[model samples]
Target: MRLLGIVGWTFCAALLAACGGNGDKVNTPGPVTPGQSSASISSNTAVSSLSRSSNNSSLSSGAMVMTCASVEGAVFIDETCPNWQEPSVFEQQKVNSNIYYEVPFGSDGALVSQKIIDSGDALYKKVWDIQYNNNNDFNGLPHFRAAAAFPAGVDMSAYATGKLIFDIKVLASPEANPDFTVHIECGWPCYSTDVRIPIDELNTWKTYELSVADLIRDGLKITNVAMGFQIIPRWGQQTNTHFQIDNIRWVKGSAPVTTKKCFAQHFDRTDWSYTTKVETVDQMPLDSSKWLAGVGPLVTLIPQWNSVGAAWGFSVRDTETLSSCAAKGTLSVSVLLPSAYVDDGQMQLGFYFISRSGLYYILDGIPASRLKADEWNTISTTIPAGKISNAEYMGVYFDSKGSNVANGYILLDNFVITHSLVQ
Candidate 1:
């Protein structure tokens, strides 16, 4: 049987709700404290001990905040996806310093139009254009207004070692035609764009941590750093579509990650599904072989899984087909998990992958410090070939944990596995 109804919705909705705010209160369904496991690594380590302190800080809500931005005029919603059917439009209330942009649509796929918050509004929304049918399935190109510059100049060079903190609400478009990366123009006006990071899913609001140093190494400059959206078309065609947007911010002087491209990948366009029971596990194998959990639970057929109180993911297991010590196979997956449930003892979420190298581990555990209780978060990791084993098959996993009874939930999508240089 499927885990259905309002309880399931409350769980998932509460989780997504936890991703924003002024970094004040913890918003999940539980108290503020650490949860289940402690041990963690960068996918470069083994499952040695489960007791060691993992970098739970990565899950906490600290420096991330969305102060209220002024807005004026009519913010309307329209039909921009494949079918020009109008989806439900809800309230655009500015809550707790963060703008909550809500759209009510059924499981059936429908593109929610862009809400225009006047140019003179604190954000000057016009700088960020919501273009349709540009070149991809449900495409949107957000151009920053010259006025939207950093109080401190945007240095593409500094991003290599600075911090990238911003929140985005997106719905998975399709598998092979997934939402593209968040590009920034680094030079003057910072107009030269590159996909430094992609918004791997649909139907959820995800807050991302972008490493400034890593951005520079990836060919982005530090001057005039600007963020925008770009989506590709699917079904062997291109079309313009509308997606939602709200609470976008960038914190200055943030930390950066190491610069290195370590994975080869393939294109995907599958949507997301939702669930709240053991049977939900049956839906997310990489492939039909069952050896690999393709994508399930919270993944919609048309790929929209952004409903409230729901969590989704993908997984894969490996066989003895790779070298045991090669140190560099290919691991390419992009994931976004809303941090809304980090403080909810009733909620636990994570991703797991087993390699053919006879090695296996998980990317999740109980909540810790890095992830806050009610905010959206973006996480990316690579699975090296040799990191597992020379086994023939490998498996991948994505799970959002909670009390069997349920309280809070998660929204997730965009399962990608690519080749990278790892050891």
Candidate 2:
């Protein structure tokens, strides 16, 4: 199949390395208490006048509180304090105390429109109203990030036993539902795994909590935390969507329990069918299906560099409807690279997927150094729950990077699709 020109190879390489790749290990933080001080709050009078209650808090004047909770032992991040008429403390970068900024990782022509919604007649006073539009350009995977920084690197050791809490409501979304990720960043390359917001819980104001210990376990440094909190949209969220966020804070307690189960489904050799497309180069026609083969447990893919800088790969699809396996799924396969290609390092192999929406999902770069020459290396990529639920045709695609080495062939086997479900 012809790979869409959505993302450039260099940009994809950097994104893969920063998102989940391994990096230099740092010293782990020492033991921490549950309620020790970790963050600094601005001297805003409005924030200091709020009264804490057992379940929620309200202004001393008895004004209603729209947040899920504002109890004792809680550190406020951004409560939308001082009303909406005043200037916002949040910015596009970290400059002072009680301030946050966006990562500015080119949004692929996505336009972000913002406004302060004054809900005087509702439970809350005001909130942030943000809308995202892709502007019809899907050449790159756009990223929407709002990162809050801690001045002088606060000691968040106390919250290690608690959870990061925030309130969100989705007002609009595309046909394919999309979720956002929460991150705790210490510095460059030091970040937590993408803690996704539940796709099923949207359209209404709801409180979402993430365990701080889980963030630490995923390489987050709570001791000398530079950026305390962040919210980012996951990949394949290209269409228009509208959402609202409020009452960001860190509270001392564990998250509420829920009943969600996840499992995996392995695809046998018979489950996959080979597919290819015809190409014309220099007035000569070439068909890749004639060169590719699928036998027993191994599927061989030979790249055809029809012209200079040309890119193509072999594909196999299974028309099985995996709508039930929603939440999040990971597709994995075993690839054995030829010794010649591994030694030359002129070409790179990467994994891509075709979502039910016909959107192409590409994984991080698979450098030669990461692959075992002449040995099987497991390659995988994650599919969002929205795409997984609407999926009718599932498949695995192998794309080559450069056009230098066109002779070496790759061996693929062991196709599997794993996902979690809310039972």
Candidate 3:
């Protein structure tokens, strides 16, 4: 299993007999994306669409091409700058072949596989074209792999601000083989980061953006990167499959992510953790605080929290430990106020989760000045889940909206959520 502190190894193809006939050496490749970093790493990450031969080789043989200096978040790096090259020899070699060189991919070109004639063909300028079948699976590995290791000194801190990018499109469908899966793997400190996304979007030049923060949350570190960058395929058993991959980069933008909804929390003394914040002792007139349950006789006062004054903000306890309730959901509460309370003050509520670690509450409604007065109003609004993929919890802020109050209080009870996926 891929977990913290565990690692995996992949070797280079050893014998020429393992290769599918040597196609003629091809052309140079270009790169892409953008980001921000503290280290001296290049911030220009942009991909220029270069014209290519049918196989993806550059139209002009031996002519230099332009690519992203880096995709951590920056726009574009100047490839024309002679000083721009792989930082060390470690980043310039094949995994098993210690040739101390960048393996040329595509028809013959790009990245750690700069220009050495290796396994795949260059479909176009700065892109690697791999046409693989089960017979060509190197050393009987699970799938088709195109990988290049970056030397030890390369810092991936910039990824925190952006995403990992893969510019690719499939030329064949699962009809080539039913169980097709594309695995993007990176070796980070303490563990290997592998994301398995199903090969579903077929035969289109689609750009996939993966969040860098999400990887770190899964136990990857930005400090130590000891693995080669690779995109491999698995379970493509037959029916020749063709694909063009280029602009493998760390970028500033993010690809759209899918969401699964089903979570909720009810604010009850038995279900909540903030029991100490409220009290059971009533300060009102004798029997005034008694509950009048519709179907029951009468009930005494119970532990509860009451908010007094303006700008009162309270959240569920330990939401930090739960999955982010980010983008969408609902927050509802039973609210009661003074008889003279007006509808001038507004209420705000929402969800927020950043980097899969911190929990933040967004502004659901501040200009919302429609809270009913005196009687208990079940106030609720939709939660934005897109703001946080894994939403942890939610909160509501009762703002006076600049209206001065005279010893007023907002009584809240039975706060809860609906369709919340978090436990």
Candidate 4:
């Protein structure tokens, strides 16, 4: 049912990790708190947890223990990984924040585009021209943000402990003493800092580092950011200052498990029209008028379990795959039951992994009693490994007992998919 009629027609490429604002509010449909989606880790680890307590909104990692295999749902999403998990630690995250592009770019396979925000009168260009003979040994080269490239509210707090690493070069523009200031932010309040580049430094290519911890030194929380990153150049006005930034990224300590999440559905949208049921990103039947900024494919599931046999299942996409994502498994959901339904007792929510071999590995049943009455509640569980060592797909499947005779149906949203980016 494409219920939401056409509202408007404006669209942007749909890449969630670096998405400016698709208006897609991803939720955790499991029994855990909303937004607590992380890879399954050992409770005994020095760091008990690494999660965003966004008040069901979205927060950041607190100072966690140093030793670990990997953080599931790490800050950096492998632009290419189907399951959204990074197989390895991103020592350097190339700064290509404006991923509003026609196609994907970078080794991470992230979306690449010219620019999302207008640079105003300032002239600019994306170039491989001036490595300008930079002195620093660049990790990844070729692409750089040149001229007045100012990407706004970028999310880098995930690498808060890491250093802000990059290299800069100047083209010796007519604008005398042309220079720019790079602004980086931390936390929801947007605690930020700006570093100025002098004319002398502009002449040659050089590497620079800004301590992520130092920027938030006033005891600021970087785990979650209010505004991610911004770079504003102030030189001879109208006089386009020519400079290029190469290898802009964060240098992190270690690799952790990651789970990139995309909203399949969020019935919570009140103001506009919404497509209630969609199985994949392409199926999102949104009122494009309101979503003038195009929407990604909608993730949907069939609540019916009778003839279908499968209650909820999602076919992987080119952007998503059953690739290297399986080391740590995750299942999450948000559900609401009415008073009368609670009167009848609980319903069981089962999570499963259907491997390429057609084998099924089901987690324990989650009792609906764990859900709140009339209020959306989240529940999550760690999928046991081995059984899913060769997972081809994953989803939730429940007996029709709840859909058939139960006083109410199980509401699912913010479907969380997981897999190891690393084999």
Q: Which candidate achieves the best TM-score against the true structure? A: 2
Worst ten in a row by lDDT for model 4: 45-54
The digit string of per-residue lDDT tens for model 2 on 174-263 reads 745565666555654445444556445456666666666445434455665655455555444534777776655565544322212122
Candidate 2: where are CA atoms >4 Å away?
1-110, 136-152, 254-423
- Tens digits of per-residue lDDT for model 1 on 86-167? 2233222222324333242332112223334333434323212232333332322333322243333233342234344443
Candidate 4 structure quality by residue, lDDT tens digits, 1-423: 011111112222111112111222333222111111112212211100111101110111211221112433222211111122221111222344332222213233121112112212122122222212221211221222211223223344456445555445565554566545544433222333234434454445555554453343212234434333334444113123345443344555343423333322323333111322122111222232221221122222323323311233232211134323444554454434465444545334444444444444445544444444544344455544444455444454343233443323443433443333345
Q: Over the stretch 1-423, how does candidate 3's per-residue lDDT look in tens digits? A: 000110111122111101111111111112211111111111111111111001121222212233554333222122111212221212212333343333322322122222212223343344445554433222111111112333342345544435555555567643643233222223311322234433545665555554454343223344443332344444324225566555555554332222222222222122233311211111122221322211101011221223322243333332332344334454444445554344544332212222223323334332223333443334444444444444333334444333454444554443333343335
Whole-model lDDT, candidate 3?
A: 0.32
Task: Give the distance in Å from residue 164's predicted Cα in candidate 3 to where it truly belongs.
Answer: 0.8
Question: The CA-based lDDT of model 1 is what?
Answer: 0.29
Give the residue spans of candidate 1 off by over 4 A.
Answer: 1-141, 144-259, 264-313, 316-343, 346-351, 356-370, 373-387, 391-402, 405-423
TM-score per candidate? 0.32, 0.38, 0.31, 0.32
RMSD over all Cα atoms, model 3 = 23.9
**lDDT by candidate, in order shown:** 0.29, 0.42, 0.32, 0.33
* Candidate 1 accuracy as TM-score: 0.32
Output the lDDT of residue 355, model 4. 49
